[model samples]
Target: MKVNRFGRQAIVAGAAVATASMLLAGCTGTSSSPTASADPNATLVFGITADPTQTIPWTTTSEQSVQVLSQIYSPLLTTNKDDQPVANLADLPKVSSDGLTYTFTLKDGLKFSNGSALDSADVKYTYEKIMDPASKASSRSYLASVASIDTPSPTTVVVHLSKPDASFPSGLTAVNTGIVPSDVSVDSLQTTPVGSGPYKWAGRVANESISLERNPDFFGGKPGAAKVEFRIIPDDQSMVSALKTGSVDVAIFDNPVTAKTAVSNKTKSMEAASLQYHVLQLRAASPVLSNVNSRLAIQCAISRQDVIDTAALGSGTVTGPITSPEYRSDPKAQPCAKQDLKKAKEYMQKAGTPDGFTLNVMTSQGLYSTAVDEAQNVQAQLGKVGIKVNVQALDSNAYVQKWLAGDFDAAIAQNAGSADPNTMYARYFTSGGTYNKVAGYSSPELDKLFADGIATTDTAKRKTVYTQLSKELVDNAAWVWLFTPKEYIVLNSSVTGFEARYDADVSTLWKASLS
Candidate 1:
C-alpha cells in the first residue's frame, strides 16, 4: 500500500496522541539483543529520515512507524500504486450483491514467525481489538461500519457492514490493523509484532536503527535479502553522507533539495507523486478569516506555482480543489485564481480589513521539510496585497495539537490523499468531521452530498455528487490548496527490484534485493 503519505499520518497522529501514554511500557526494548555485523551481500540497509514514534500496530500515527511494521506484518489486503485494493494475505474478497457483506478466503498454511498458525481466528482477533474502544487502536474509525464478523472456518472470514461501504475493502489494506496471532496479549502484541509477512522482527536500536530478518517460511515467498536494516538518520546532510560512505544502501529523503543532490554516481534518484499535499488552513472563527471575501483575498494572493518552485525545487504539481490529481474528473474544478494584488486589495477592503491586522501563519520548523519555506513564500505573496502576515514555526506535535484544537488563525500543514472521495471530502466538509476541526466550517449541502456520495455504489452517480462537493468547497475558499511534492526514493546501484510508491510505505522492501 502507499503507506508513507502525510494524510494518513495526520489522521493516525490524532488517535496516536490520545493513546501514546498507554504504549510506553509495552514498547520498551525487547529481550533480544542486536546481532553481529550483517553480511552486506545478504542485507539491505535502508535509510529513513525519522525514527518511528512507536512500533505497535494501531497506536502510532507515524508513517515511518508503519513502514517498519509493514515489513514485519501482513494485512489481509494491500493497495497497488494506483491506490486500488489488491489481495495480500487473503484472496480477493467476495462482496455481496448489496455490498454490505464481504467474505475473505485466507491463503493456505499462513503462519506467524513464531510458528503459530494464522487463521480466521487471527483475523477476528485483529478486528475485535480495533473495535474494542479500550484498545484505542487508530484503525477503529476505519472499521466503524462493521456490524459483525463471522469466522465460518479456519480459512474463511466474513464481515457484515451496517450499510453499504464501497470503500470498506480499502480499509483492510491499512497497516495499522495487520493480522496478528489471536493468543497474544494486546500489550505484548504492541511491542513484539508477530505476523505472517516476509520479515521477522530481529531487534531495534531506538533513534538509531531497526533490523528485520527474512522469514524463510513466508507465505509470499522468502524475501530476496537475508536481513534488512533501517538506519534512522534524521538530517538530510547526514543521510547524504551515509549514502556516500556505503553506510546505507538506500535513502528516503523528505526534502527535494537533498533528493536532487542524490542524482549521481553509486546512487540513482527515483520520484513519485506523494499522496500528500500542503495547505494553508484558515479558521472560520478568526475575525480576519471569517469573511468569505477575506478568505478569497488570502486564496488569490498565493501563487502556488511560486511556492512549488521555491519549496519543492519546481518539482511538484500545483493543486486546486481536487487535491488528488488521479481522482480528478470531467469539468475539472478550476485552479486557484491568478495572483492579482489589485483584486485582493479590493476584496480585503470590502471585508473591512482592519488596520494593523496581522495574521499568524503557523508552520512546522523541521518535521515538514518545506513548511517553513512555504510559509515564508506565502508571507511574501500576501504582503503584496497589503495584508500583514507573521510566520511562526512550531514543533510538529505542537502544530498538530493547535490545528486539532482550532487555536491558530492560519497554518500550513500536510494532509493525506484518499482513493475514495468520501474519505477526504467528508472529513473536511461535514459537520464535526475529523479534519473539519479547522475553520469549524460546516455546510449542510456538502454534508448531504457526502452522505449521498458514499451511500451509492454507482460510479456515475458518485462522481456527480463528489464533483458538486468539490465545487462547493472551492467556492467557499475553505482553504488554499497548495501543491503536492514530487517525492524521490534514492537507492544504491547494487540494489534491485525496489520501486517508489505514492503512499511511501516502506513495505516496498519486501521485493528488494541487496546484492
Candidate 2:
C-alpha cells in the first residue's frame, strides 16, 4: 500500500558488495522524471497474478507481495496520497467528548464488489472478525487497540476501546483491516470475495492466475489500466522474464535482479523507500527464544550489515527493530549489534545452557532474495557463538500459516505494510500484541510505554513514547533488527505520474499518465 515498490534475487553476482553496487547503480522505481501526461484510455499492464498467494485477509499480509488482495480489499482507513491518515471506508473519524469512543461517518454511496451496501454492519462485522484470534490476520496488530465496534446506524459506526486508541485511525488503513461479511470466528475466509476497491474479480484462473476488471464507479474513480490480468509466476526468473518479454507490464518482486537488465525496453521500475521492516521473529513460546539471555545472545551474533549488503544491496538504511520513522520519530534509532562473542556465550551459559541450542528458522520464499542466504549466514555466524540453526523455506501461502502457528524458533519477516510507528510497535510489543508476542514477549515496561503512546494525539508526546519503546524493544533482544529497504519500482521512461507514498499504496491510476 505505501512507500510501495519491489524487486527480487535472480541473477547471481560476485560478492555482497558487488551485488550491492549493482543495486545502487541499476535499481529503479523512483522515477527520475514526472509521470507522463494522463492518458485516460491508456492500458498500463503490470505484472502480477489474479490469484492471490493467500486470500485469507487476516494472515495475508505484505503489500507488494500480495497485489490483488490489497486492491480488492478495504481497510477501515488508509494512508491517502498525501501520506496523511485519511478515511477509506470511514469518513474522517471524530472522537467522542469522552476519549474512549470514536464514531465514523460512512460514505453514502459505497458498495462492495458483489453489490452489497457498505454499511455499519460490514464495518462492525469486519472489526469484530479481525479482532477475534481465530481470524488469524497477519496484520492482527491492527485490532490490538480495538475493544469493540458498534453500529449505531447504517451510516454511523461507533468504536469502543479499552483505552484512548490514537492509532486506531491509522490501523484502519492496514490490509489486515479489510472487511469480511460472514460471521467468521476462526473459520476459513470465503473463497470468493466482495471488495469495495477500484477493481472487481472476474474469475480465478487455476491456482496460478486471476483476472480483474476496473470498477467504473470505484470510489476514487476508475483506474486508467483496465482489464488487469494477474499471472502468478512464483519463480523470480519467471517473473522478471514475464516483464522482460513484455508479456506483462508490471509484476511484484523484492530482489535486485530486475534492475540488472532494466535498460532494455521491458518497462520502467519504481524503487520505493518503504516503512516495511524486516525482523527476526523469535517465538516467545519457544524454549530457547523465550529466555532473554538466549535472545540477547542470538541478537548479538547476527551480522546485520551482511544481510544488508547481500540481501538489500545497500539500497535501504539500517534501522533498529520496528524501524518505522514516520511514526516512531526516534532520535537514537540506530541499528544494534551485540558483539563480543564471549559475552553472547556468557548470556547463553547464564541462561543455564552454556552448550547453546539448535532450532529451525523458516522464511517465505520468493519474498526476498537475500532472506534465505541471510538466514544461512546467520546460522553459520551464530554457530561460532554456539547456536545451531536449520533453515526451511516455503512459498508465500504456507509462510503465513506457519508463522501464525508459531511453529519455528525464528521467523524472518517484514512488518508487511503499515508505516504508522504506533501500529507497528504496539502490534508486536504490547501485552497480547498479535505480532508482539510472536516472540512471546511480555514486557510491562514496553506495554506501559506503548499504552502511553496511543493515549495522546500530540506528535511530540507520541514520538517520545515510541522512541523509548523502540530503544527498549531492541535492548531486550526480542529479535534481531535489520535494514529497512527503500521500496523499489522500475518503469519505462514512457510511463509517468508516479510518486512514492509512505503508507504502501503506490499505484493510483488517477495520478498517472503515459506517452
Candidate 3:
C-alpha cells in the first residue's frame, strides 16, 4: 500500500496563525510536561501533518490514518521490534504441514472497547469484510488466497487458503487488517470504532484534532498514557514551533529541514530509515507513454540524486522497487543511475518523437513538502532531451482521487514498501491486482514471477524470484524509482519510551509517557 506523503508547507502557510489558534484552543486543559517527572496519566499531544481521511482500518492506505487506527484496533498478529510477525489479538497460529491452513486461538478474556466480548467471530468477520468487493479495502489483495474461514468455536478460527503462501502470516500483521466486531456497522466504524486495542476513539474535531483514551477492556493490560491527542499541524514550520513552545510533546516530520529546525529548538529527535520511497509514475496506458521507449527515455533523462539533493536536502538514498535488504535490487544495476542524455535521445528517437514531445505531470501541492520541487526538477531535467514537461499541481484530495482512478499522464508519488516483496508489489504488478490499472502495466511473465515468489516457503528461492521480478520492473521502466527518505520523530526531552519502527509505525506510543 502507498502511504500518503507528508509536509504540506505551501498550502498551509497562510493558515499557520489560524492553525496555531486551534492548537492553543485545544491545548487549554492538557498542559505540557517538559520539566515534570515521568507521568503515565499525562496527555501526550502528537502532531501530525495531515488529518486522517479514513478512520475505518481496512479502507485506508494513508500512513497518517494507519498511525491512529493502529492504536484503536488490534490485529490478529502484529510485528515485533525486529519486524517479525507476532501474536496480538490471538495466540500464534498453528499452520498445517501443507501451509494451506492456519488455526488461531483467540486470546483469553479479549474484549472490545465497548465492553463486548471479542472472539474468533470478529477475526473471521474482519477478514471476510476485507475480501468483500463492497468494502473496497486497500488490503483486499492481502487476503487473496483465503478460500474460506471457519469459526469452529468462540475462540478457535481456522483459515483455509486456496494455495500455499509463505507471506500470508506477515500480511495479517498489517495495520489495515485490524479486527472489528462482527456486528459492528462498517459505516459507523469510520467515526466510532470499536476494537480490542490499547486505545479507544474518544472524539475528533474535524481537521483540527483527534482524541483517544486508554481502553479499559484492552487485553494488553493498561496503556502508558491516559489520553492521546493527535493535533493536525499542516505546516511543518508550525509543527516545529509547537515543539519549541512545548505545545506538542511529539511529532513526526518527513521534511529534513523542518526536523532540523525542531532539533535546533532543543527537542530530542531520532531518525528512522523508513520503507517509504518517492516515485515518478508514468501512466503506461497514456498515448505517449504507451511506447516503452518513451518511458525508458524519461527514466534515463532524470537524475534521482539531483532530485534528492534539491527536494529532500540530501536526506535519502536512491532506491529501486524493493527496499528490503535481502531482496532489494542494486540501485547501481539500474540502466540510468547516472544520467545518459545520449541514450535518452536514442530512446526518444526510437519512440518516434525525436524532435520533442510534451508530457503532462500531475503532482499534489502541500501534500509532500518536496512534491512540486521534485516535479519541477524533473521538468527541467527532461527538457534537455526534448521532452516538454508540464507540471500540474493540485490539492491533495484532487490528486489522490485522480491518481486512484488512473486519470493522469504521469504522477509524482510516495509509496510504502514492505518487509516481504510479495506483500509490497503483488497488488501493483499482478494482472488482477486492485492497483493494476493505477500501475498501468502488467504482463504474464511479471505475474508468473510474483506467483513463483510466494509459492515457496524457502527464503533463498523467494529471494531469487523477487530479484528477477525487480529486474523486470526496472528493465521495463514500470516507474521512475526515486529515493527512500529518512523519517524523523521529534520528541520533547521529557517524553520517554517511544521507539521508532522502520515502517514509521506510531503505535509504540501506547508505551510512551511524559517524564
Candidate 4:
C-alpha cells in the first residue's frame, strides 16, 4: 500500500533554514574501502526514522510497517525490479480470455514460518479478509473488483472478478496482499506474524527497535544477512552518527542535507528516484474550499519549485498527480504550473472571498523530513493572496489519524505513487474508493476515468485514459501537486550488495550483507 513513511521530530522553524544553508555550502567527503569479504551470518542494523505504527500487513497504511512486514510476509506475487508482477509463493496467474477470472497454482512445497502448510485456502482467506468491509484494509479498494475466490484444490486458487481489471495482478503484488495461514488469528498475527517469507519476526521494543531472523522454512534459500535489526532513530543527524559509529550499517534518508552529511562522513550512498511526492490536499467539502475557485486560488498562489527549494534543498522534480514514467502528467502542462498572484486573487474574488479568508492546514511535524517546511512555505505564499493559513503541525501519528479522517480544511501529504496510474490514484479519486472520503470530492466523470483506466490491458489506451484523468484533476485543482524528492540510500563502507528500487522499498535488504 502507498502510505506515509518517515521519521518523526517536533516542528522547529530553524531546522529548515539550517538545512538550506548546509546545502549551499557544497559538502563533500572522501570514500572508504571495504574491510573484508561479505559475511552471510552478520547482523545488519538498519537505521529507520520511525517505528512502524503496527505490524498487521492488511490493516496498515503506514509504509514503515510495510518495510518490516514485507520481510515477514510473502505475497503470492511480488514485483520485479521493473515493477512488473512476478511469481513468489505461486506461479504467474493464468487469465481467462474475457479477463474476469485468474487461476494461480501454488509452488510444490510452501510452508509458513511456523512450519504449517500454506495452500490455496490461505490465499483465498487473505483476499477475503481484505475484501471484507470490517477488515478496514487500506488496500480494500484495490481489490474491489473481486467477486469471489474459489479454491478448487489445495494447490490451486481461482479468483472471479466482478469486472475486468488490467491492474489486478499489480495490486496483488502489494505487501498488503501478502498471504498468511488461514488458521492464524488476526490478533496473534498483529504482534507475531507467520508467513512464508525470507525472514521471520524476531522481536521488537516499542519505539526503539525491531529485529528479524532468517526463516529456516522459507521456500527461498538463505538470505544474505542472518539477522536484521531496524533501529528507530528519529533524528536524521543521530542516524548519521549511528552510521559513522558503525551502529547503523544501512539507512535511508529523505533529507538531502542529512544524506550529504552521511556521504561526507565517508559513508557510501545511492540516489533513487521515488514515486512518492509532496502534495497539498484541499478538502473540497470544507466551507472555505467548497468552491472550485477557492481551490484554484490556493493552487495558483504557491510555486512548486519554491517549495522544493525551501523544503528539499532543491533536489527534486516538480510534478503533477501522477509520477509513474509511463503515464506521468507534465508539470508544465498543469494550469497552475507557474505562480500567478493576480490570477490567484481573481479566483478568490470569483470564490466570493476577495477580502480574504482563513484556512487550517494540517501537517506532520517531521514526517518525510520537510513536511513542516513545506506547510510553512505554503502558508507564506497563500498569505500574499490574502488567504490566511494556520499551520497545525502534529506528530506523525496524530497527523496520520487526522489525515485518514479528513479532519482538516487542508493538508500537506507525502503520498506514494505507483507504476500503474490506477494503483496510485483509484483509492482517492474514484466514487467508491476507500479514501474518497479523505479526498472529499468525486463525480461520475472522475469515476468513469478511473474505470476506463483499469478496464483494459492495452497500455496505449490506458495511457490515454490516464492523461485525461490528469487533466481533469489539475483543471479542477483536485490537489496542489508539488515535487518528488530524491530518496537517498546511505550505507556504511562495510555494507555491500544493496540495490535501490524506484518505489523506495527497503525489502531488498534481504540481499544486503556486511563486509
Candidate 5:
C-alpha cells in the first residue's frame, strides 16, 4: 500500500539531518553543539534517515529521493502550507472552457543548472515520457487524465485530457513529476538527473551522503548554502543526538520526545502536523471483523487520546479518514469515531454475544516508534470491551511483506494520501484501492463518489462530496482512525530562512543559510 510505505520514508529523511556524529559516537554522550562553520554558505550539512532508493522521480517512492530530486528539478507548480497549488516553474495553466485542455506559459529565459535552455519542449517531453506505457511512472495513474501533450511554442505547452479534472493542478506539484531536460535519457536520469532548479548534484558517497552545489545561473537566484551535504543516519535516537552536538546543522525528529531532548538555546525546534497518520486496518475477510457491528465496536473501543498521550507524547491530533486537519475545516465533514465502551459492548452483543476474540495486530519496529506504542494502547483499549488484541512488532521489510500479503488479522501502520483530498481518500476507501485489495472491500457508491469528487473544479461541490465520503467510511468502520503524527525539525540558531513545508519536501532549504 502506497500509504503504508511511500511517504513515511521521508519522515526520517528530513528529521535525521543533524545526527551524523551520533552514529559514530556510539553510547558515549556528547551534548555540546558543534561549532558553526566560519562561512555558512560555503557548506551546510543535513542529516537524512536513509539514502534515496533512486534519484529519478518516476520510478522511486522513497521520500528521501523526492527531497533530493526537489532541489535538482523544478515542478510546474508547488503547494502552500495549506496544500493549495501555486505556480512554480511555470505560471498557472489556462484551462479551456470545457476544462479538457490546459495551456501553460513558461517563465522567460529559463535555464537548467547544467546550462541547457529549458522551455516548453522539455515540459512536453517529460509529460509524454511519463505517459508512455513503458515508462512505468509511479504517478501514471495519478496523471492518467492527460491524453496528449502539444507544444505550440517554446514557452507554451498544451495538454489535452480524457476528461475534465479540477484537481489536476495538484498532481503537478508532486516532486517526482519534476520537469527535466528532453535530451536526458531514462538511464542518464536514473544516475544524474539534470533540471532547471536552484541546485545541481555535485557528488554522492553511496550510503553515507549526497552533495549538491548552488546553481550559480539559476533563474530563481543562487541558493544561500553554496554547498549542501545530506548525510545518512539510519537511527532516530542518534540523529537527535547529532542535532544537539552540532555535528550537523539541521535534522528532523519524528519522535517528539527526542525532539524535546535536542531543544536548547543554540538549537530551535518546530512541531507541525504531518500529512501522514497512523491507522489500524481490520481484515474485511476475517469472519469476526467482517461483521459491520463488530467493526463499529472495534472503532468505538480504541481511544485516540490515550494513543496520542502515551505513544505520541501529546504532539498529535485525533484524526478521521482524511487525516490532514487542513481539510477537516468543513462544518459538515464527519469526525472520527468517539470512544464509547457502552456502544462497543452493545455492538459486540449484536455480533453473536461477544466472548472475547483474539485480534492479532501487526506493526513495524523500523517504521515509527509509535506504531508499537499505539498498537499496545489499542490492545489495552479493546481488552476493556472483551476483545483481546495481540500486538506483533516486526522488522520493516518483513512487516511490509506480511502486510502486502494480507497475512495478519489486523495491522497498525501509517499512510499519506497526498495533498489532494481526492487522492487521499480514494487511495484506501474506494474499491480496488492500493490498500483495499488486501481488505477485499468493494463499494460502487464509494467508487462513484471518488469519481465525482475529482471530476469537478467547484470547491463547494467537492467539499460536499468528500464530507459524505468521510461519513460513509467512518460509519462503515473502514479503518480505525488514529492521530496525525507531528513532524519536528531541529535547526541550529545559525540557520536562517528555513521555513517548514507541510509535506516532507526539503526544497525550502534552497533559500536557507547557515551562520
Candidate 6:
C-alpha cells in the first residue's frame, strides 16, 4: 500500500505491454490527440484493469485494478519520476531526532477537484477515518504510525508515532493513504469521490467504467490528457485483444522474461515495471511449506534461472518474497541459493518424503502467468528432485481471496514493487497482517527485527537490523521467492516526459506530460 517512496508505482493491471498497426496507430489511438509541441489540447485515453476494492483513497491500496483509482485521489506526498520522496500534498517529510514523530508542512493553495481546499484537517480526517476500526477500511496497516494527529491550523499538522517510524512518509504517499476532504461522507466518498489529483471523478457508468475529466485546479498544473476513460476487463486475453482492436490504448501486462521482448517489440505500447514484482508465494502456515526443508527443496528444485529466463522473459531475477537479493541487507545472504540437488533431495527425505510432496499451486488466471508457468516448471524440476506439484489456476479475484484466506498450499503472486525495502520486506513480515503478507509467516525474532528497523531512522543500524531480519526470513522460508523483475515498457514515441517509477499505481496520469 505504501508508494510514492522512490517513485515506485504499482501496476494495477496484471500483465502490462504491445504493438500492431491496427492495435496501436489509429486516429483514436491512445496518444491520438495533438502533440504538446502542437496543440497540446488533445485527449489521452489511458487503459487499466477492473474495479478497485474501493474508491475511498484511504481504503484503496491496490486500486490499480481500477483505472480511476489514483486519478481521483491525491496523497499527501508523491515520489517524482526520480523516485525520491517529495511533497505531493504536504511539503517535504520531516522526521524527529528520535525518529518517533513526523511533521509535514502543507502545500499552499491545493484544492480538491470539487473546489474544497486541501489542508491539514483533511489529512487528519482521512488518517483517522482509515485507522478507525468502525470504518473497516481494508488497508489500515498502511498507517501504523500516528498515535495522534494534531492539526495546529488548516495548513499544518503533526503526526505523532506510537514508536519511531522513519519510513512513515512512504505511507503518506501510498495511494490508499490519499487524503480526503474532512467533510466528505462515507456515502459521498464512495459514490463521487474528489481529490487534488490530475483528474476529477466526472461520473461513473456503474460497474462497467469510470469517467474522469482533468482537474484544472491541480497544484501540479493541468494534466495534458484532457479527458481520461478507464474500462475494466476481467480477462487478460480480452484486455490484450482490446489493445489489438484499438478499444484500449494501453494494456498493462505482466510479461515473463521470454514474452517481454516480443510484447515490447510487438506493441506500440510499452511495459514498465510497476512497484509490484512477480513471485511464487508458498504459504508458511501450511504444514507442507512450514518446514524450512520443504521450502528449501522447492527453492532448489525449481530453477530460479529457468524462472528468470522463461517466465520472467528476462525481466526478472531470483529473489525472496520479502527481500530480493538486489535489495538484500547483507550481500552474503544471497537469497535463494543455487539448487543443491543432494541437499534438496536429502532434505525432502528427512521431511518424511523421499519423493517431493504434492500441493496445489494457486495462481491468478487473469493476472500474471509467470507464477503458473513457474509452478509447472517447478513441478517438473521438483519431480527430478522427487517432488510432485499440482498447479491450480484460479480467477484473479478467487486467487486473491483464497490465497489470503490460507486456502491454498502455495500460490503465485507479486510484490507489486515497494517504494522502499522497508515496505517491501518489513511490512509483510509482521504478524496478523495481510496487505502483502505471503505464507502466514510470523516470528518473535522477526517482530523485534522489524520493530527495531522501523523505530530507528539511522541508515546504518537499520541496514544491520534489516540484514539480520532478511536472514531470519530466509531461514524460515516463509515464501519461496522467485525473482525481482526488471519491468519493461513500450510507449508511443509521442508520449514524452513520462515518469518511470517502482510503485504499481498510476502516477503518469498526472505527473506525465505530452511532449
**Top candidate (TM-score):** 4
lDDT (Cα, 0-100) at 35 in candidate 4: 64
Tens digits of per-residue lDDT, candidate 3, 1-515, equal 11223323333333442343233223211224556666767888998766777888887666678888988988898887667788888888999999999999888889999999999888888999999977777788899889999999999999999999888888888878999998889778877988878899999998789999999888877787899999988777788889999899988766655565676444677766677789999878889799999999999998999887666656678998898766787887777878899999999999999997999999875456677778888998999998999999887667777887889989998888878888888878889776788889899999899889889889899989988898898889989999997676778877777777775677667877876
Residue-by-residue lDDT tens digits, candidate 2, 1-515: 11112322422344643553455346443344554455566555555422355666666654443466666777767775545678777778888866788888888887777676778898787777677777665556666766777887888998887877777777777666777654433333445666777777676766566776776666777675666566666555565666677665555444554454443554665555566667788776687677778887887777776666555655555667554555543323433353457778888887888998987888766555556666666777789977888888777657766766666788877665355576766666677777654656768898788778888878888877777777787777777777676544555455566555553354353344445
lDDT of 3: 0.81
C-alpha displacement of 16 in model 5, angstroms? 22
The models' CA-based lDDT, in order, is 0.71, 0.64, 0.81, 0.81, 0.71, 0.62
RMSD of 6: 6.6
Candidate 5 per-residue C-alpha lDDT over 173-206 given as tens digits, one digit per residue, 9 for 90 to 100 = 8776788888778788777778777889888988
Candidate that beats the other on TM-score, 1 or 3, i.e. the better one? 3
Sorting all predicted structures by TM-score, with the top scorer first, yields 4, 3, 2, 1, 6, 5
Question: Candidate 1 lDDT, tens digit per residue, 55-84?
Answer: 667665555677788888888998887777
| Error at 242, model 2, angstroms | 2.0
Clashes in model 1: which pairs? Answer: 2-503, 3-505, 4-503, 4-504, 4-505, 7-415, 7-416
C-alpha TM-score for every candidate: 0.83, 0.85, 0.91, 0.92, 0.81, 0.83
Off by over 4 Å in 2: 1-45, 48-51, 62-66, 138-141, 147-152, 180-189, 326-338, 492-499, 503-515
Clashes of 4: 0
lDDT: the better of candidates 2 and 3: 3
The candidates, ranked best first by lDDT, are: 4, 3, 5, 1, 2, 6
Local error of candidate 2 at residue 124 (angstroms): 2.0
> In candidate 1, how many Å is residue 435 off?
4.5
Cα distance off (Å), candidate 1, residue 217: 4.3
What TM-score would candidate 6 get against the native? 0.83
Quote model 1's TM-score: 0.83
Per-residue error (Å), model 4, residue 44: 0.8
lDDT of 1: 0.71
